[model samples]
Target: MAAPVPLHPARRAVGEALAPGELNLVGCSGGADSLALAAAASWHHRKESGPHAGTRVGAVVVDHHLHPRSVEISGQAVRQLKGLGLEPVRIVSADVDCDSRQGPEAAARTGRYAAFRKAMSELGAARVLTAHTKDDQAEQVLLGLARGSGTRSLAGIPAARGPYRRPLLELARADTEAICAHHGLTWWEDPANSDPRYLRSRLRTDVMPHLREHLSPTIADSLARTAAIAAEDAAYLESQAKEIFPTLLEDPDASGALRLQLKGLRAQPPAIRRRIVALAAVAAGAPAPSSERLQAVERLASGSRSRGPVQLEGELEVYRGARGTAEYGKLILIPPSSG
Candidate 1:
């Protein structure tokens, strides 16, 4: 109803991350962060007009259909988007089996991304916006470190990947809440966020504070900086891999069995070799092998062969040859069969 305020710093960050006039699809979850992002983007679209001015900016909210009230919450999100002058689009609901080990959180995330991707494809959106913030990045880094993840995992969430972008990654959750308040908007908070039963919730409510008290006061910022540095390093590593991966990648068939010569792989440095193996495993949809397993694979390539096919979680198998030849030390990633 009122003229939108000039772009706040948070909104400016969004505008900078995603240039104005680009066709964007926002993944709005009715949460404070996403609501603020949607409102900011809408304002940006309104104030600027050009060849890209009329550029389409739409909203998609995944119901998740988890809790009984999830549908109602989604409806509220739609109304909020409409209030902010966005055309809201409904997406297909995913039937998530919450009983899985990863639990409802992982299922919802998987389903949410799938739905967003589908909507983006259908709408021909050049890019999609997510509301992952600085706090989330910090949390991710801590979680990854707690799990003893490699530098790749510590890299945290990427700023731009394929059709996805996170404009709010530089801002904290508090800033999002402030932006919503500035716009006279109220948001629904999911109760699950406060439920201590979830590991993340417990970390946020308990572990982080304890760490802040006993450890460095700037732990969050430090972790976030580590993540940023890791991301830059990871990007450079990937770029390097691109130059050699083609030669290193094994021949592929319709069945999607890909094998690379471990001998050739060992010629590269440890970092590059591990990256090649991890990338291959991901392409094969197998759980990425740990650093130890990758080291073992390297040993096999160097002629110290494993007794049998070295299997990694997610179906990636590394075969050791007896002859210590390029053909003998082969790594194959067998793709997951269709369910």
Candidate 2:
């Protein structure tokens, strides 16, 4: 067998995140990024000591079946994983629902995460690592900017979400490809990455190239830095909102909806105020509210007039009703009408 190429930086990140002997699962797509991650994880396992000694590394390739040869691609990934001596290799099929309002990419992403959660549970894995890199972060920032998204959207991809972690968020895509080449590993390139139909593909293959050539030489790195700063700001704001939430939310009604008292909420900064309203909506069983809906609820928090009651998607309604004071009423999340 050939020697596995070393990935010093990635190894360090994975090592710091997980204890020795713990199971580390990689979400591999046969692409260069994930393939390199798998190789790096294997090397990290080989060097483990203490309780982490003999750490088990595995790969879960989620097959969305959106293409004609997805299964073939998955099989090739399995072969490559086995060649790297990774155990517990599994391929999960995801049911992607495209009929909804969300874009195709989002639907697939949702399905893929569900599969990863299931894999974690069945494998008893302590962590799941993905291949999202700094380049992906730049693209995300661009999308968020184009859509006029808030700080949370501009924060781009997080390094860690629950049990899932992206250890390569600081690394570039070229680095992953180079790592694969150094290991003498072959990686499968997905056709979806190049298809112009997807906005992300256009951003990756064309828009970024144009910007790199004509715009600032370090545009990608700069955007990635923006994301890091935005992430920091978002974390602080979220912590503040959580602290203030208990005071703002009145007792739940018969319908289990939490009412937001304007007396305390109206004085907070807009960022924290919006987060409070959005969190209240989600807590009341509304799926994450859109930016427009969030703003609508925020206006209600201020006791705005002229505009009628705010009707959010999923039949969740938000309105201001007299509770404590006439001048400043409370904003409430009403459950979807059964009728």
TM per prediction: 0.86, 0.92
Query: Mind sharing the TM-score for model 2?
Result: 0.92
Per-residue CA lDDT of model 1 for 255-292, tens digit only, reads 77777777678888878887887777777778768877
Give the clash total for candidate 1.
0
Q: Any runs in candidate 2 off by more than 4 Å, and if so which?
A: 1-6, 46-51, 306-308, 322-328, 337-339
Q: Give the TM-score of candidate 1.
A: 0.86
| Model 2 worst lDDT window (10 residues) | 321-330
Tell me how far the alpha carbon of residue 228 in candidate 1 is from the true structure, in angstroms, after superposition: 0.6
Candidate 2, residues 1-339, lDDT tens digits: the string is 854444798777766655457788989998999998888887766445565577888889999998899999999999998888888899998889988678899999999999998898898998899989889999999999988879999999998888888888877888888888988888888888989999999999999999999998788899999999999999999999999998888888676766777778889999989888878877888777888888887776676763336877667887787546542467767877421
Highest-scoring model, TM-score:
2
At residue 21, give the lDDT of candidate 2: 70
